[model samples]
Target: MMSETNPYMMVGERLCMDFINTVSWRESADKRREWFTSYAKWVDWCIHAEVLTGQQAKALLLEAEEKPSEAGDVLKQAIEMREVMYRIFKSISKDISPHQPDLELFNASVSHFYQTLQIIHEKDHYTLKFKQTENNLGIMLPPILQSAVDLLISNNDLERVKQCEGDPCGWLFFDTSRNRSRRWCSMSDCGNRAKARRFYQKEK
Candidate 1:
């Protein structure tokens, strides 16, 4: 059920999966639309994806204005990381190993971001947190990366990761169906179109 007005279609049950699905028509060269056109757009998606609060997004946007070039560089880095993640996860969904270079790139990001990891005691309970500054424009990326890492190491859960069978739609989602019969990115969109196509061909 995708809304016409809303650009955010979060069928991916996992945060990292949704992040990997930021592009529309990913496998279609002509129709593909990149959601993260700028740092501000990335921040906007981060807010929609619940990776950032309104206040944090505002702070980051302000900082980005103050350092436009740095912001652009961070955006480029984020997109590159996203492509690497997409390839790795897509490979996993196909029951294949990710390319060695892609895995190395992913490990590099994991190593870099996890350095900000720290333990915090709140209300007599200990929890791990990324303790980077509030205005860190790339702060939203670490959590998404952690989500991917968690899924990758979950072993059994890796079986649940699937790419939509909707041709060039190319969205990935965590298949939560009990029988694992799910296929398209959405029953209302890709699924319906596929169904109609079958009917049309039969009639023809």
Candidate 2:
């Protein structure tokens, strides 16, 4: 059963875009920094999904000091982490038999993904220690990822996981519906866009 107050589920489809685009796109230092800044927004969305409280998210962000030079690499790692989570969520949704090899692979993947994050966090100097910033900007992943993983493990329900059906928007989301029939990432965004496009084509 889905929790009534799971913040991670409320992050919406945009979270995936933010995670993937930040790393995949090539831009100047300023643009990279701007994208990194969106991390806070991602955390905020996660908080809304009930994955983490606002206080907890804020503290997590404070744990690592942001270095301008490291922004690109950090973004890359974030995208990788998001992709791993996406795959795990999708596998859980498959409803495969318990003895299936695919299920076993999915379980192993989740474990390895978590361990890899830990190893990377340990090796990165920016993530190893907390530092005070003039503008109070810092970045960290431990608390955020931990909270999300804990929620998924506790629930153990694959039905809550969903991939958006919107065209050109292959984002992952956690469906919290009673009927479990959610399709688009957000009705106001992707859903509306799709509807509008269809209408335009019909008019033509």
Q: Candidate 2 lDDT, tens digit per residue, 1-204?
A: 125664232333333322333221122343333224455555555465444568867675664334534444454555556556545555555654333453455456446445444322455453522232332322334444554455466565556666566655555566667788888767876689989999999999
Which pairs clash inside model 1? none
Write down the TM-score for model 1: 0.95
Candidate with best lDDT: 1
Q: Please state the error at residue 124 of candidate 1 in Å.
A: 2.9
Global lDDT scores for all candidate models:
0.91, 0.50
TM-score of each: 0.95, 0.48
Clashes of each: 0, 9
Pick by TM-score: which candidate is best? 1
- What does candidate 2 score in Cα RMSD to the true structure? 10.6
Off by over 4 Å in 1: 2-7, 133-135
